[model samples]
Target chain A: MNSVVRYFTDIYKGVTSLWTGMKVTGKYFISPGEIVTEQYPENRATLKMEDRFKGEVIMPHDENNQHKCTGCGICEVNCPNGSIEIITKKVPNEQGKMVRAIDKHIYHLSMCTFCELCIKTCPFDAITWGQDFEHAVFDRTRLTRVLNRPGSSLKKKEVKS
Target chain B: MNEEAVKKVILKEDEDYIINMGPQHPSTHGVLRLEVCLNGETVKHMTPHIGYIHRGMEKMAEFNTYKQLIHLTDRMDYLSAHINNEAVCLAVENALEVEVPERVQYIRAILDELSRVASHHLWWSAFGMDLGALTTFFYGMRDREKVLAIFEESFGSRLLHSFNTPGGLMHDVHPNFRKHTREFVKYFRKKLPDYKNLLTDNIIFHNRTKGIGVMDKEMAINYGITGPSGRGSGFSCDVRKVAPYGVYDKVVFREILYPEGDSFARYKVRVDEMQESLNILEQLVDDMPEEGGYTAKMKPVIKLPEGEYFQRVEAARGEFGVFIVSKGEKYPYRIKFRSPSFSNLFVLGPLAKGGIIADLVAICGSLDLVIPDIDR
Candidate 1:
């Protein structure tokens, strides 16, 4: 008789405990205002990434079509995956002596882990992180981009003064 | 044929039933394959087969410099990414013998507690789903997002923030870091009671977990299980308590323990730990130094002098140790990581031997085996 009473009490306790869990869920179920999910594609127009998001590497050019990269290949050397390559060519400096200058600053987006090693190691602030994360492409060659625009030269102030 | 010969043949025909639990299954959490031997629904013996997701991180560390190696540790035990990064940083700093500022210490303690709470939230969500409570996932994720948002705001990455450098942080934390952390602590404290109301008091949860996987204190010590799982068996092995690092020496928090040595005890240790993490954050937030620079004077090229160095810290799951052997080079001679999951995983065979096959999931979840940490 005592075992029978204990069995029923156990059932009652379990049912009550289950109902308590349901109550917490039911409160959120009835109120749609408590939903935390975001509709991703629909909200793309207004979606704002954090300012410091390390999406990809970019070389910023000034209005005079001048960049700060000096073809030192510090970024190329510092990159763990060899993501950056600075092709250099001979050019005349202030004294008219042939010196190494960046011909093209190549950045491989596909190889970047976005670890920010390059940006941190750059002495001239030559490269920075771009916030645009949409990098899908059909051709693999498109990811291998030349960061310096056509006919862009080194900044005047960036030369050894 | 003789009747005795026919009876012997019939008895020999029934062999041991063997099955594979995962290399793709969800309950295993990652690509861990368990070869479980069974007899009439009772698990007789089990062996965990790892190495599905091994990326050869230790071998890769041989070539990469000390700064670059910091990010690789993030991949191992990805949940405790901050603490993993700290292990490498502390190891490198100790070899270099550079002392980081008080501000860096205080900030690191805050991030450690925040990531610990986030990791516990994820474990609670997945552990509940393993036990057939689906609603817990959504609730757990909802609160976990608030912590991730705090991380995303400061570190610029949500999951694997490799923010720690050899000397200090890669950069200073954002101005709102303290304010947002305080807000999260206040908000999460109120919701912790809801977690209790939903799961802790539920009789079904208790019945499913209560005396299921019993691992005693002596076995826990023998296995070197040094996390919440070990603490569940009343073995006090918190690295922070045993050997405090960073600002851990300044703060006061209890090392949560339970003598029951059951699945429920392990569950309660993690749940209670989330509250203790909040206590740590509260003590740390207001007391953070306002002026000290975020990073110390670190050389551009960090080459460790010579000999070996090791650093251990309390990860969300257990004690994570980093062993580095430097021969006065930019890269390490050889690197080894003493991950908790690798040691904690072997004890599962003994714990699950007599239990039903269904209880295997509960035992695995209680141990909280992050497979990549094991494989790496």
Candidate 2:
């Protein structure tokens, strides 16, 4: 008789706990305020984020598409993963003397770890963080981007000069 | 006849049976070996042997470039890949003197919370299975798949996603990241109560778990427990709120806690934590910064300035600490990863000494022992 009473009591307790837990879930399901889900993409017009969040990097350009990068190769040397490469050349100045200019700045997106060490090492204010994230491509070669263009036609260079 | 039956039931003295729970034991979670000394059903003493799954990540981090180590961090807590990546990225970002954009910080916080929820769900499912609740295994996996789908859509990889870099994120959030994460959290939130009802509220599970493998608050503190494991014993040590990294402090969320220091309490801690995680996700989806300069102007070839920096982040398991020593070079001199599972695994021997064999399994599951976290 004692064992039978103990068994029934244990069953009652088990059922009560289970019922209580289900009630909490049911409350969320039944009430409109309980369901705290927000639809994405459809509601992306209303999406938001904090101000100081980290994203992808970008090289800032001037009105004439003039980039400040001198191609000093500091970013390449500073990158731990060899994600940056720069080709430097000596161009003839007004005095017919050879002066250094960045010929090519190659950025391999695949290898980039985005540590941001290069931006700090840059003596010339060149690369900055970018916010464009939809860069998915089927071909890996597309990720390797050239940041510098041939010939310098810039008003900013005259200001600095 | 009664005396003869009693004699048959008596144990034969001096006879010992050894059952070795090898590194392959399913219930052991990772490659943890245990030599069980048993006299019939009662376990005399259990000798747990570890270090089978050691990847020597700390030692390896010394050779790999700081950038390369981020992927290795993913292997440490394979389930919480984003959290591990965040810890490593935060360390390198600090060392390089790079500031993350406000938008990326919020994204990291949201993803880390989602990872925590997914990890807890996996733990609950496996713990129930350890306790002989077979139905929970299917239910747990189904819920975990929802979280994984969100991870895939946002990070491009479900597990071991090396999505975070030193300065900030590898890429900005996919245009659909916020929408997918919110949807996943909603569905997962709806499904959690079923788990509670099926397992926690079940009579057999409660009777078997409650008061079994009780851990006092003092022992829990002295052992340096954190996350759900520490919360089970009332530690309330949540790094997200404590240090406020990656925009976690700016957001509103509460750390779930339980005063009881038993196996069931630990289970409750993780269960309630999933809900809190949902709460954080809800807020993140509602307040995602849509437009911003996501990544800072950190150079492509990053060299760490000479210095020692300690970075701490709350992983799904507990506090993950990374201490990096650099000599103003591309490679770091020393990288030490203070893993949460490594510390939590120590409590098992002390907790399991006098408990039943089944209770040992209970404590192991409650502790949420991830072998890679221990081995890392």
- The alpha-carbon RMSD over the true interface for every model, in angstroms, is 1.1, 7.5
With a 3 Å backbone cut-off (N, CA, C), the pairs that clash in candidate 1 are none
Task: Compose the digit string of candidate 1's lDDT tens values, residues B1-376.
Answer: 7877985653322487878999999999999999888898999888788999999999999999999988888989999999999999999998999999999999999999999999999999999999999888988999999999999889888888989989999889988999999999999997887799788888988988999999999999999998999999999999999999998988899999999999999999999999999999999998999999999999999999999899999999899999999999999999999999999999999999999998999999999989999999
Q: Which TM-score does chain B of candidate 1 obtain? A: 0.96
> How displaced is residue B318 in candidate 2, in Å?
1.0
Quality class of the docking in candidate 1, CAPRI style: medium
Candidate number of the best DockQ: 1
Distance from true location, Cα of A62 in model 1, Å: 2.6
lDDT of each: 0.92, 0.78
Model 2 over residues B1-376: C-alpha lDDT tens digits?
5766764554322476767876898898879987776777667667677788786778877877776677788888888888988888888887776778888888888888888888987898899899887767767877788777766565555666677877777767777778888788778777766776778778788777898878888898899988788888888788877788877876788887888889999898888888888888888888878887667877655688888999988888899999989887777789898899988888887787767778888888898989988887
TM-score of 1: 0.94
Off by over 4 Å in 2: A1-5, A14-161, B1-16
